[model samples]
Target: MSQDPPRIVIAGAGHAGGSAAAFLRQYGWKGAIVLVGEEPNAPYQRPPLSKAWLKGEATAESLALRPARFYAQQTIELRLGTRVGALDRTARQVTLSDGAVLGYDRLILALGARPRALPLPGAELAGVKALRGIADADALQAALGPGRRLAVIGGGYIGLEVAASARALGAEAVVIEREARVLARVAGHTLSAFLAAQHWAHGVEILTDAQVAAIEGEAGAARAVLLADGRRIPCDAVLVGIGAVPNSELAEAAGLDCAGGIVVDLAARSSDPAIYAIGDCTHRPLPLYGRSGRLESVPNAIEQAKQAAADICGRPPPSPEVPWFWSDQFDLRLQMAGLAFAAHEVVVRGTPDAPGFAVFHLDAEHRVLAVEAVNAPADFMAGRLLVAKQARVPPATLRDTTQPLRGITI
Candidate 1:
């Protein structure tokens, strides 16, 4: 009698899960590969959803990470419009939403995060939306056009990107932020101020230090945002981009360790060695920062996919990647690397008002902790290397545009 081949089951077909399945094949995993997702479409790029897709510049086909035929060619089973309903750790099996029971030798949890909905009254109105999937993007895109007024409830990257896209579509945009400045939680003051100026230059109204008391609606559709200070800002639609919460309930129910997200090791392994977790769903170890945190970015997703693949294939692990992120707003291309939480001193490479500039965050030891480059690819590349190398350069040298970043090392 021939023995059955070992099967690997992947839950969630987002970037991380899709990449994991591809990497497993590349890393010589000949066993059965089943990639399951709740959505009807295959894995696709998400960054463009808030920008190009919303602006009607990109199509659904353009956002795909891989074509529909890739899975068939690779012998990987693609299960679309299906979700893993229940996980049995003891039996090493999962119950699908379609009432199918599938057993696996190993399971990969790549369940991504969902938008954090607002708690204010009238938040569930027809015109109030949050973008996390293609359906949401389509709905939000329809809400934007010439003469439309979009009131963004958060000043984060998604909200700002939508605001920029709305402006490009000849619509009016207003950003409401509770913080003292835009991008306060994720970026340094220099970059935030510069971005604010760029948005203002593009005719996007920004209101900072503002609190939303409720979302007023007319006939079950959002009509205006009411502020705690009695200010009523009328809008055609409302977009809430505050943040996201990890889809870790399934993992938590299966008795896996979960904090803000699923707690995972460097190898993306969960509490149960037979199960691994990756992407935005995992609160993974950040070796560079000497801590653990959740990183919601494409780079982070791909990195964890590689990690999980290597472990399963008995291949050598890939080197830890420097955490990085990017955003597109107006005509600006912002790229950032590393964490700036513990930085003591900040250095600027070029004038903020200039077309190209880089903001560097350094610890007390003058070690480069993070870098934010706006339309400055050279600075972003060099800063990434410096951060990975943990290089220390004098703050004055960093401020000197004449001193090449590639040559500056102390």
Candidate 2:
């Protein structure tokens, strides 16, 4: 008699979990695979939630990562609208919210993350929402229309994206940032200033160095936002987009190493060899950054999923990747590569007025560290290659728009 293959169970059916299931099949895994998710919908692309989906340009069905038939045909058991309640490492089993326990020889935790919520008063008021899942987008989209006003509570990518989308839908939008400038924690000052100017030109009001004291409401519905500076901005709705927190509670409860996120190695293996974790829920080492951190991008999730799949299949893992991210606001397309934190200097290529530019962040040794490209795809691609190679280039050469980035020979 032939022996049965090991059972593989994946928690959190998001991008990472879905990818792992597909890749496992691609890599010739004949074992029984089960994917568990809290949401009713199947796996879908999240990048569209704040952009095309919010603007009503894309349908919910269009956002699916794979068609429903794909999952059925692949023989991948999908447990939708089901949550993993607890994990018993000793028994190598996970108990679901329905009180059903599923045994697994190998387990993958792609739990992802949740949007950080504001603890201020009136936070639970109607018309106040955070954009993370499709349900949130649906509620926000229904609230947006002509003559409506939206007050965004953060100046980060999600906040700004929603603000732009609100304006595109003929709604008045305002952005509030506690810091002196927008994107203070992510992009450099140059990119931040350029984005602020663009949003202002598009009729989006941006308030910096501003703090939200409370979200005042009437009859359990959001009415206006009260600022710390004694100013009240009337709005019909509010969006809280400060950031997100990793969904590492399952790993932590299981007694696995977790610190803001589940700690993992390059192979995506957690403390236990029988388990692995990936996506935004993991704090793994980055070779290029020379440190450990959590990356919240689609590319990172896909890459980590592939690594974990390979390790589970006893195949060679792919090479490490340099971190990258992208954002779309109105007509602007921003692509970034590498970590620019602690850079010595920034070199600007192209003019910001032309609405096409790339900012190169270099260390004191002139080594390319990071690149922020706005409407400059060529520069972004070249910069990614250069940053991966740790190539050194003169600041003057980067500042010259006439010089082709490909010819820099980095």
Candidate 3:
């Protein structure tokens, strides 16, 4: 008798979940694939949500990762608007919010993350929102208008992006960050300086180290922002993008090892071999970073999903790939393809003031750790291979604009 095809269930049809399902089908997984999502619509890309979507440059229809017909054609079951509440490992069944149970031989937890709420007065006002979900985006979009004021409650990536978009729409943007510098949590000192300058040059009123005490509004709509320092700034809209918390409630309730996120191995498999996790909700070991930390990037989600899909098909063990990230801000296209923190000294190669240059970060031993380039995709690509091999290059040579970036490799 021939063995039956495996029944696979994937929770959260966002970046990682949807990609894994499509990948499994591409890998020739002749099995039943069920993708469960809490949202009412199909999976979509999130990178452009704050910029293009906010600026009316991209519509909701253009955001779809794959057409609805694609999933149908691939024979992948779509369980949109369905929430998976619990996982029963021993029984190999999942409990949903609607009290239905789904049995699966292999499970993928792509639960993703929930937006971090800014706890302050006026936060519950109608005009205050977070940008983690489609519903949140729609609410914020409806609140935007010409001559309106938009107060952003954080200075992180999402907040900065929103501030830029709001300003472009002719709305007054006031960014209140509790840190001494903008983007303090994610970037190093130099990068933070550059990003802050970028925002300031674009006419964003950035207030670092300012704590918002309350959100002031009338009739449940935001009107102004009150700081702990007793200063109130007039505004019509507010966006809180402090950070995000992993959506690991289902896994934690079911006794999965979770710390900040669902703990997973190199193959993106959770503590329970049968259940694998990926995306922002996972606290798996990242080999490329030379550390184990929760990475909340879209690239991390997609790559981990691809690896998990391969593993589900009984393929060879896949190790974590080189971590890569990018940010599309205004006319600047910043590209980073490896671990930026593994460096001690940074060499600025090319024109620094010209908005197009390559910054090479070297380790204590002077080995190529990472590279940050603006409008220099070629250097970033070559820098990835250099970091992978741990090359030791001369900082002075890297700074010279005359030589091709690749020729200056250590």
Candidate 4:
């Protein structure tokens, strides 16, 4: 008699989980694959939730990574609206929310992250929301309209994006950031200043170093935001976009090593060889920087998925790519490649007042550390290549836009 094929169970059917399934099949894995998700909808791209989707520029069907028929055609089992209650590491089994237990020869945890909630008073009031899923997007969209007011309680990407969308819908938008500058945590001062100015030019009020004491509401519906300085900003809705907390509870319960996120190796393997973690849920080492950190970008998710698939199939993983992220606000397209936090010098390639510009971050040795491109796709792409190759270039050449970026590489 022929032996039964091994079974692989994936938890969290988001980008990471869904991509892992598809890649596994592509890698010729004939095993029984099952993907379990807490959300009812199929896997969809999330970046659009705050921009295009919120602006009514994209449809629900257009957001899906793959059609429903694709899963059936690939013979991949999808358990939508299902949750994994617990993991039995010893037995290599997972108990579903409905009390059904499934065994797996290999397990992948792609349990992404959730929006961090504000613990302020009146936070639970209606009309106060956080955008994380499609449902949250729908709620926020309904609240945005002409003559309405939206107070965003963070200066992060989501908050800024939502503020832009609200403004586009003719709603008065205000961004309250506790830091000294908007995007202080992720972006450098140059990019931060540019974005702040962009929002201001678009008539969206931005208050940096502003603290929210509480969300004041009446009849359980948000009416205004109270600041630490005793000033009140009246609003019809409030969006809390402080950040996200990784959903690594299941991994922790399963006895996997976890810190800010589940600790995984470059191969996306956890402490246990049979188990792997990927996407925003894993804090893996960055070969480029020789440091370990958690990345919350779609490219990181897809790359990690491919790595996990390779590891599970006993194949060599693909070459590691430099980390990159993008944001769309108004007509500005911000693309950042690599981490700019530790750069010693920043070189501006184009005039910020113009329609296009790029910021290149370099170390003492003039090695390209990161690049922030505003409406400069060519610069962003070249910067990504240089960062991945660890190329060092002359600062003067980088600053000269008239010179071709590819020829100036050192």
Ranking by lDDT: 1, 2, 4, 3
lDDT minimum window of 10 residues, candidate 4? 1-10
Please provide, for model 4 over 86-151, each residue's C-alpha lDDT reduced to its tens digit, 9 standing for 90 to 100: 999888889999888889999999999999989999899999999888999999999999999999
**TM-score against native, each model:** 0.98, 0.98, 0.95, 0.98
Deviation (Å) of 118 in candidate 3: 1.3
lDDT value for model 3: 0.84
Local accuracy of candidate 2 as per-residue lDDT tens digits, 1-410: 11266789999899999999999989888989999999998899999899999998998689999999998899999999998999999888999998888999889999999999998998999999998889999999999989999999999999999999999999999999999999999999999999999999999999999999999999999999999899999999999999999999989989999978999998899999999999999999888878899999999999999999999888999899989999999999999999986799999999976568999999998999999999999999999999999999999998988888899875
Answer with 2 or 3, whichever has the higher lDDT. 2
Q: What's each prediction's clash count?
A: 0, 0, 2, 0
Candidate 1 lDDT, 1-410, residue by residue in tens = 11168899999999999999999999999999999999999999999999988888898889998988999999999888999999999888999999998899889999999999899899999999999889899999888889889999999999999999999989999999999999989999999999999999999999999999999999999999999999999999999999999999999999999999999999999999989999999999999889999999999999999999999999999999999999998888999999997899999999899669999999999999999999999999999999998889889989989978888744
Q: Tens digit of lDDT per residue, candidate 3, span 1-410? A: 11155689999999899999998998779989989999998899888888888888997779998987999899999898888988888889988877888889889999999889877777888888899777877777777768888899998888988888887787778899999998787766666777788888888899998988998999878899999899998998889988999999999998999999999988898989889999999998867556788888888998888889888887876555677788877677877766767568988877666577777888887788777777888888877778777788878777777877677535
Model 2 residue runs over 4 Å out of place are 1-3
Lowest-scoring 10 consecutive residues by lDDT in candidate 2? 1-10
| Worst-scoring 10-residue span by lDDT in model 1 | 1-10
Error of 3 at 345 (Å): 0.9
Off by over 4 Å in 1: 1-3
